[model samples]
Target: MLLLRQRGSLSASQLADELEVSTRTILRDIEALSAAGVPVYVNRGRNGGFSLLPGFRAELMGLNQEEALALLTAGSIGGRQVFGLGSALSSAMRKVVDAIPAGHQAAATDAAQRILFEPQADLLSRYRLAEGISETVMNEVRRSVLDGRKLRIHYAAEGRDAAWRHVDPIGLVTVRERSYLLALVDGHDRTYRLSRVLAAEALAAPAERPSEVNLAQLWEARSARFRAGEVQFIVAARLDPARREELAETALAIVHETAESDGWLRMELTFQDLRHAAWAIWKLGVDAEALSPPELRDVLHQHAVEIAARYSPRGPTLATDA
Candidate 1:
């Protein structure tokens, strides 16, 4: 029933392909469902397929109070189209609603509605273009991952031109609404963000991935490295009390700390690289001041001087003015 609801109709062969079974199996199952009083029928022609009668729906999986609350805690992430699970999540959400006792559905809906998700208005935006991904290319990418096959992809990395490459697509995931394919390139793992994928062709050859692939474990390891100060530097900054929470978001862990005069916080933080610290503190502006590590302070000073120069009036030499 769920499958029929997800797709209005399917031929026997198509159902067999999806279920990894023979067409005879699907035909027998169809007969059994009909025998059980299901409103299933088939159209016998070139454009015909098996379909459920209109307004027919099967009973949904039950959701206990804890399960309902857990889905509610997911907080519409399932509906955000992240990882392309929106349809499945929507169907699941409908099931959750349906499985609730008649008297409790309204209460569940009301509780979910009470939660709000507010995203910051960062200088960089995350919305997609109107003319989004090509259906053909995205389909091939997904096919390769699900089928455990290799892929020939035209990918572009940051600050470089696009190039075509062969990859073994292990899995695909969405982090912060951004899509990425975790694949093996040149026998090493690499994360290719979807925005950088210009084109893709799914290859029939099986991927050279490990027999046991764990997406969660792989993502966690990569994320830890990314947050662990790539170049490994110690940052000493005098931060205003107001920016305390802001600093927590960037650092992997707070290595050390101390109190300062006038409610300011002197902290020892870690960053991936020097460039990382430079670009990061630049944003905090006056809220944070790099104290130790002369190199970091130098970077900030140079940036400040440059900004001052841009706003300074274009003028003749001082001697000429005199």
Candidate 2:
């Protein structure tokens, strides 16, 4: 139903591939939809597919109060603002709320208020948000993905100057507040950070991409392959119970972890190198202890000594520009 509404029409094979089901299953589902009074129509030909009749729309009447409340509360988190869908989400939510029966509407609204999600920073650590992307560039990239057009992007990759590249935009993905454009360059998979896109242009050429894409599966496979190629420097440590979640968010990866009897967290972690490990542990201040790899402990100790010396009253006065 959603695919028909969004794309106007799609073949059984296309629907099966997108949904990860067999063509037989898709045909059965189509029959089921029609039997359930959904206005599904099929066109039989080499270049034909199924579509919904004009003026036919799936309604919110099927949603019960509890289900509606869950969606309403989830929307209240406001994460859609980062994806440029805030206004659209607001409008959709209004329609959802208005569709509830008058007797249950007040109860559902109250239930939604009982659930709260705060996206604020932690008190003990400095939180840094992801870099912002240009709205114009994002819009252009989005257009290429939705319209199945090739894109020409001026991108600045890590340690490289901005350069023009042509790619077929597959999809857009947001992970841990950072947005990435999953694309194909020279018929190979590539990922680009949205923040690094200095400019983007949609091309008239149609994108040569798969008829169907499982974005989450694609992202997971690419991410696994990326991690496998990186250098791994493992460290064993003890971390504060209160800062466990913070450490997980900040570190490259927590390879292994367990809660100790004493309430602290004991863990094995992987980092890029010695310097990376030292910097991460140092950020936690006294809350984290490097338990092994004598060199890591030595590095942290030396850094602490240097910091103490720089702050000593007898040491050189803090520099000031006059």
Candidate 3:
């Protein structure tokens, strides 16, 4: 309907191609619009197309108090920066507040203010390394995804040199602070970190993608496959509450945690492998103790013995050791 109103006329195939849907779907949408009393009509010729009646304008729907408050609180969640729509979100939020009944507006505003959402980090003071995304590069990638066009990108993957590649972008996903571009490279599934995109170009050619895509499902499937390939090493350990932040930062996953009578946290944690487990537990020093996996305990015991031997006053001097 917006397309017809703006362009005056566009063929069914043209609308389908522009919107990335089937012509049958476009026809159904047209029918729905007509049934909804939109002033839409079809031209009957080879060059003919659909058009809206002259001077027709869609009415803006008003929101109730609860809906306005929900939008207000949600808009404050810091996600609008994903596509650079922060200003637009702010404007929309203002409109929502103003559109609501004046008597309810102040109450809604107060309620929204009291309902606080947790930020990206928890209260443990764990450090998180955020991926840096360039605005110019992001804009280009976003364009490719929205326009359904092929994208040429200069990307630097982990442990690899930056290089150019062409991909058909399916969608962009933002998980917490990091963003990913789900695309196809050489007709195979590939996911690229948006921060790793040094530069990008939106090509005129349309992207080769499925007509319908479930980005969430696709991301989950890829994540599951990736996790399945990693080594799972679980370590049972007791940690001090004061050092919880340090443990959370280093461990791959914390399986379970229980508070002991001695005020220490007994935890079953996961690491990439035995080496990772050893390094993490050792870094915690006396604040943590590894209970299970005798191998880990043995490694720590040997490390402590070596340290004791090095500092022992009665031990051999450097000259004697050499």
Candidate 4:
């Protein structure tokens, strides 16, 4: 309809043919348009079909109820963070909504009211340093990947007291709610958590990005294969049937349940890490068991040892080697 208006005027049959719809549909569309305050005009006799009054804005004739409502919702979310752009987005949303048919306004408003988005705590908190560094590195890395350029970064590893090597940033990934930078260090692709990073600077000199190793493909493959030492440790656990169903919905572990035997259901799971798994098992207390990857069993044992040491007759104290 707006496009037809831009062309000055067209008959109902002409609009139906242009829009690839029936003539009745075009008449109904014109009626809806006019009812929405659009200056649509019709002329009778040999040469007249429909036309917009002179000086009428064409953009005002384009939006439908659904599109207007979606824009309004997006504008609200955007305005909460980037103030300047948010205001402009909100203004554009208003104009589009106002252009929609008045009869559809209530429906659009209702739809907008139903939409909701929950922002993450980490994102809401102004972690300026982490955000700024992550943004710069990601943008530069993406540009470098496209342009086939190399990057130098200063990073720190978890459990290490000092910052290590100037690495070539290859790709980035997010696993278990944390972000990591995947890079090539000494000819091998290594993953480094962004939270552990201290500082990163791109060397003026650029190295050629390798064609054989596509960062995105490599990340997907590694993620699928469940690569070792990738910030998460896999721990196997056996859970009772009742508990298995509760854990099935979580990404933290993959659970497999067995048939109930003697009124107790048996199941197994692969945990993302030991610390939380141990704590959870302690809560389940008697129903869960840390099955494999000796380290996980060791973690459970250590917890017990700590508890024993805390309440021992001599009071909490570490046993010293003779």
Candidate 5:
């Protein structure tokens, strides 16, 4: 019946044929819908078999109040980060709940009493401009990817002046709660974080879709290699057993822990740079040492020398030495 109403209206014979039921069955179904306050009407002869009264819409049949609230809460959260959707989403949800048949209202209210949503602290304080820009760029990128269009973007890179370039928008990705646009630039595809993009505009000419190269697979391989580059040296450490657990949680390096006698721990990890690794080890205060990668050990040694030089007694005055 809902499907028939969605199509505007249907004759009883047509409804029966579509539903694979007898005409009498269709009549009974329509009667049941009317009883449930569906506002169904039947017209005889040359015109209509049945039709929903003008402006009538199907109401929620089985959802309880709690379920309705849960759906609304989720929609609200999504609306906060999405561009221009908050109030409409809230209004639409209310309309849906209000349209529920009278019989189900009590059940919905009961369910609502049992359900709750606690908003996160940062949910209401999200950066609106950034969110709006991200949403716009993402929507445009998706459209471009689907239509095989080229995009001209003003991109900003760390330590370099911002520049504009034309690219074939191939994909969009979300990583660590941030969005990025993946594009084919100068014969290679690379990801540009949307936050770093100063501006983006679509081009008039569409680019040809590449021949069967999987964008997602290429992205994963490239991203992994990029992360791996952050580790420049492998530094081995001997840690006190009690302190070993604390050191293991560090993300600046990858740590390998080994059992050692006398309550000591032997571990090895990769560090991006000697100075950074040295400072981190120093912060551990006493239980850690840079055992391998002589360059990193030298860095620690140099730091110690510098600290000692600062505190050492000044050379005897010339007159005193004489």
Candidate 6:
């Protein structure tokens, strides 16, 4: 309708291409709009096409204070781009901006800029990594998930080539600028990076999933299980006061900790596994020490010995001890 009103007239094929629908669907919509008394009309000549009655300007949809504010805020956050809805969101937001009572639009625009979501403190390292996504493919996956239908995806895991699989998509999520699709394959939940998906096809077959699904609960449960590790171990360490914040970022959790008279922190923490704890302590360098759980200390010692041996002309002989 907007296109008809603004451009005066548009052919059915033009509308179909612009909206990514079949010409038949476009014609059906024209008939439906006319039947609904929307004043839509079609002309039948070389320069003739679909158009609205002369001087038509449809009134915009109504929006409440909270709803209007949400649209403004959401546009600022760029969530639309993550879901491949950038163009659609832009069109919707333009309508919303037009619909907002003239008196409130300026205030709404000003309010959105005050809040921000910063994922990384260092701006230089915070680069967007999303790649190889097309708006059409994303919309297909999104629609299938919402429609309770299965999707045929050509997925490539971390080090594998893409292979087609029919999976039940549970939900989609965006963290930072990357998007993820959580789905079920062979009755097990798996998370796939949207960037790694080579193609997507919304299948007609219904998805096999629980009647009622809570993606958030499922995501958290799966994350906890994956992090809980096969063998849970406790790590005790003496961490430097200045490196406290840095250490916090490295460890999964600090079970317990206290300040010592010498300005070090005596702490017990959980590690997903032995290797996780070793790598974390290794990052702390001289500022932290793994003090207990003989295995953790042993691994740290082994890592340090190997690192030192690499520089010592004493060679592979000493590196073997590590």
Q: Could you say which candidate leads in lDDT?
A: 2
**What local lDDT score does residue 184 receive in model 2, on the 0 to 100 scale?**
94
Cα TM-score per model: 0.63, 0.67, 0.60, 0.49, 0.49, 0.64
Q: What is the Cα-based lDDT of residue 159 in candidate 4?
A: 60
lDDT per residue as tens, model 6, 39-119: 988788998889899966569877765688887777776455767777787667667666666678677667766756553
Could you give candidate 4's per-residue lDDT for residues 1-322 as a string of tens digits?
A: 5545346669988877765679999889999988999888888789888988876654457668768887767765522323113334544655666577767867887787788654343556843232323545545555544454566555666566746465565656654445667776667766776656555555555554466666678877767666333437555566666676565544344645556555554555555666756666666666777677787788788888998888977524535524
Counting clashing residue pairs in each candidate, in order, gives 3, 0, 0, 0, 3, 0
- Rank by TM-score, highest first: 2, 6, 1, 3, 5, 4
- The runs of at least 3 residues in candidate 2 whose Cα sits more than 4 Å from the true structure, single-residue gaps closed, are 1-62, 122-130, 232-249, 254-268, 273-275, 286-302, 313-322
The residue-by-residue lDDT of candidate 5 on 1-322, one tens digit each, is 4555446679888877766679999888888888888888767678766877776655445565556667655654423443234445655655546555656655664565565443443557754333335556655655676677898888887668999978887766654445677777877857787777777777779764575667679778867776586567677888887776566655354557777877787878765566667777777866888788887778788878898899888776844774
Model 1 misses residue 162 by how many Å? 1.5
Scored by CA lDDT, what does every candidate get?
0.78, 0.85, 0.84, 0.62, 0.68, 0.81
Task: Give the alpha carbon lDDT tens digit for every residue of 20-121 in model 3.
Answer: 689999999999999999989989998999999987754546678889888989977856677655656765776666566657868988888888774656
lDDT of 6 at 286: 98
Candidate 6 residue runs with Cα over 4 Å from true position: 1-57, 64-66, 119-128, 131-137, 159-162, 230-236, 255-258, 268-286, 290-322
lDDT of 1 by residue, 16-35 (tens): 87666799999999999999
Query: Rank order by lDDT, top first?
Result: 2, 3, 6, 1, 5, 4
The ten-residue window of minimal lDDT in model 3 covers 313-322
User: What lDDT is reached at residue 231 by model 3?
Assistant: 47
Instruction: State which candidate, 2 or 6, has the greater lDDT.
Output: 2
Residue lDDT tens for model 2, 56-152: 6667565689888988998787366665666667667766676676578788888888887655456666564756888789889989999999999
Global fold similarity of model 2 (TM-score): 0.67
